[model samples]
Target: MGADSGFDMVPRLSQGNQDRREWERFLEGVKQYYADDEQVEVGPRVIQFKAGEWPSLPMEGHKFLRFSSKITGATAAKTGVENYIREVQELAKAVFGGRIRPWNELFDVWGFYRWDFVHATMKLHNLVGTPLESPAVWLVLPSRKDIATPEPIPLTSVNNQGNTDLYEVMAIPGRGKGLVAKVDIPKGTQIICEKPLFTLRSSAPPSMHHLVAEKLKLLPNDKQREFLSLHNNFPGQYAFAGIMRTNALPCGPGSSVGGIYSTICLINHSCIPNAHNNWNEEAQHETIHATRNILAGEEILISYANEPSQARQRKLRESFGFQCSCELCSQPLQAIQASDKRRADIEQLDETIGNPVAMMSSPQKSLAACHDLIHVLDQEYGGTVIALLARLYYDAFQICVAHGDQARASVFAERSYMSRVECEGEDSPVTQKVKGLMRDPTKHPSFSAYSTRWRSTRTARPRNVDANSFDKWLWKLSG
Candidate 1:
């Protein structure tokens, strides 16, 4: 049942103005709400709200709550207050067992804190590994039941024309731990689909330290050991926090949270990486795919930073405490200068094509610039920039379709769809929409808005023309 306030109340630290009594009242409110449930047993240090069968929250049916006294702010300095807090904690432990002890210990070390309790309709689970050998807490919120219980994808299976077991963990010369292709991996092949060991909020509060430590204590012995053994570049008193910062990848669509995967973290960074890692929300997994064909023994690399610019990438990687000596960063001065020039040109063209006035005034020029941008990106990053290429093709598709150039629009849409499927999986919404547009360009949101100046049918295709001639015709490029 919903709270009497019609909203969940989570305790928070009041500003300097709020007195201790206000905090006490807030604590009492939380206790009363949980106590109201006959199935829930409130103890001095912990509270256990049993999982109910009926739907109480938004879209979720079953719900469970386990709160520990470690969440309280009582201290030894406040004699009576400390006794009250201990009583609450002991009561919780009596009903739920000593699981709250570790949580309480962490709280003692990291000060007490509270978070706002919001209704979560989805089934949320804290995924853990063997007691001693795990990464961190992985909070799984699956929109569908199937996503929560994903089918086991074989590591060696040749499904979707990819061998997931193509890579092996190895120590690289400069990089500490890196993935090396055990077999020749072709472009667009799914390399790995790793479920996170644990996940944390993207913008967690300082009190997250205690929360994480508590979660770590809940892991099986082996899992906790594995988590503690993880590499932490940012060494400090709170080692768990450092490990999280070093290896967690963005999890959800908004990237408001992060997840840690054991095997995926082994792959190191490169400005011009041969592979890319994507968070597949639909499948509830993190997928790694080869951006280009990788030869056996070649180290697998992925860009650590989203910025395509080399200078920015170098600066960004520095925060991770490592100098990237990848091909792009370690290139000769002459080669670097040339690459930088091309990158600058690509940025300028991207700006021009994005400008509404430039597009309206000279659509043809903007289209040409898009082509130029693609050429430079291809020359610089090869198939690794397939995601960028897809966007460029979609832009061209929109422009051509708007001007009633159905033939070119169809071709661009096809190109866009293929590239998107190669980068993001076919199940992706963007890829699916582009696939539909390839079949019928007229179905596009911007069908023929501007003019029918270069009108052509969706069936238009070059016949008997050489590959070079076909490309020229497709882009309407001059000799």
Candidate 2:
């Protein structure tokens, strides 16, 4: 092997050669190894390059050898390649569905892309992985230097001939001019629907006066006034800043910055909300749906809690300087006190129910304890019971399958899959694994002694039972 051969094996990692002395040393080593390459020691073993195999190298000191060659010129991994294909499919669907079909015309006429780059990036991230908690992601897009800026979308307003129930703005105490109900709002009702008045995605913060002023300049005179009238704590400042502080609903990922809505901002806050603010990309609409029956003259409310709970509800309301007086909060003191006691009981029971020691001698007692906690939670929250049930069922499924109780394990597996699908969506890998168990419970290698306690033919109610007796039975069965 020549000195040139030594230079070819440069110590530099990737790209092209640049340094001179390092390159020279690499040339010397390459030449020496080339001359007697079969005996060139790399730790405990010699490398025979011609055979393209390295002898098993022993661990140095206590360090384990983990070596994998970096593939040259590879920009993405196999998962990345699969993701690209998935993205292409989504784009194809969007185009065929007409969401992207007018992109050329839309961009040419408006001078800016329909969807900003930041939101696009966020959507891509969500497509790949599921975060343990919240699903929203934040993205910032570059502002355009060219093209005339579009006018701000207007807040929905009253029309004389038609009932302006959807458009009428009401003054909410603490929070300013919130939209109020002129009529009864039914469950799943879409109260307000309007485009974003104007959106700013950049990190740069401007004074409220400046932001509102800029938005006003883009809109017609009447719409401008409506936008200005929206609830904002800081009235002296620009309408934009004030509205943001008062009425902005979080539309972005992970609840970072609050987003302003032209019409939806008027909806009030409730611990137990009748209405839910939701986004529909297909319709290009931000909608409010009633979760339960809302009466005439009652204020439509949306829960500010990312997760529905009394504690989180209070925190959100306090942050905005208002005490929520929703129906739940307006309930009798005794009822509220009972609810708090139940919550505390559940909290305490949580630790003991899952403890292995508690079940050491009597598995029945352990499952019984878990059942009691779950029943209490279920009474307080309807479908929320499914989330805890899913987890408990999965644990029991593993135990049942381990003990070769295929029928019992299969029942738990089905329950696990159903709950997972309802909470996390059917597409999630968590749901997929549970679905696999549903298919073949006993086939799982985990099926053995661990499942013995949960295995029972009487999975449901036993004989004639009263409400309290039935509850007791549930506890004992689960234990």
Candidate 3:
């Protein structure tokens, strides 16, 4: 869809110099941001922040230079909120486009500045932080805070219409009455339909705790006994928790403590995951979706995604004392060997792209290689390749700017922003920062003036492109 880029029919201030007093006034508005509690609501219950909630919460490292709020005395024709939004949007463009200098270089640079905003907001909003980095300047909207809640949604159990033995007990090695495919389950089919035995309002810890005493304390006495009776790797009461630790899926928010659902945790791990768990943060829910079809009696599987390489996947599976017989992990020796070679090639390219010396020595070549790897991955796996490509695009943006290619830098910045939105969701810090940078690459304080050395303006388009412009790849929209 097209974006809103048309000029407004209202009078505006000079874009060159934002007066010192004006800057102070903007800062003052930011200081009172928390005071307007009515604008933001959060927490497990989906509470809305009333205007009064602002002052109750602390705001130490939350000061922002840019402020967006309607002036109280704004004319009746335009509400204060509308005027405020317009002012901020225009200011964002001018400052990002180089029409005016930002408050400080550290607070003005895209990556650094965007992180500061996201970090501060996350702290205040009680949102959990993941280990991923964003490439844009993203602001949290009042409407889209759904991904924060760690609770699982109550999903109706899938009916066992075709198979009478839906919950039939079977002696599966390593796991109890496991749910095997009753028939050839098609790709994207729901394999198992089981509810969480009990929902814990805590987050997951960094490692497993297999000691019976540790597990016993967390569950009710009767439930603890039931848990002990379940299939386990350890025989004695001492390592029941440890067996669970080895088997359970780590589910919950980034903070507090995480919980393990007995049923879902026992499905085991597979490199070529037959099932995938998707968490809906805002709704406080999780749903496991099937990736591909499974044969009758096939064991359901899920991936850690921690190990992308086949060798690493084997190592991980072997560490758990089970030889992974999954199709991807158990491919023919030659095919497995070929897959490893592709993984090694991708890794080598990653190291070369990440090398400081290589980046500075021939950044263009490094970026081109990174782009080629991303293209190859996309051809093989579709949209799953976005996360890596997003990071590469952000890296390319920095490289382009360093080499004085503003136009190319701008293009990369936009691609980085869009890719991040798909990978990490729109509310992510990466999206925020990239969006800010994409708005105006040339205005960036770090923008280099040495265009001659960079000389990247040589368009990928041809000079004599009058006829058959449709034949060019640039005209086609990305799918």
TM-score of each: 0.61, 0.41, 0.44
Q: In candidate 1, residue 142 scores what lDDT?
A: 10
Q: Report every candidate's CA lDDT.
A: 0.57, 0.44, 0.44
Q: Over all chains combined, what TM-score does candidate 1 have?
A: 0.61
lDDT of 3 by residue, 1-479 (tens): 11111111111122322223333333334335534544543334222222211111122212222322212222312423433344344543432232122222223322112345545655555643322234455322111011122212111111122223423334566433444666676654544433434333221222233333455687776566545554443334445444453444334322222234444544556555565553433333334544555677776666544334555656554435445565666778886666566666666776666544455567667776666667655543343445456666776666666556666676777887776555444554546767777766655444552233564452433456554552222222234
Off by over 4 Å in 1: 1-164, 204-207, 214-223, 237-239, 252-254, 306-310
How does residue 53 of candidate 2 score in lDDT?
Answer: 17
| Ordered list by TM-score, greatest first | 1, 3, 2
Cα lDDT of model 2 overall? 0.44
The runs of at least 3 residues in candidate 2 whose Cα sits more than 4 Å from the true structure, single-residue gaps closed, are 1-186, 202-216, 234-239, 281-284, 305-318, 330-335, 341-479
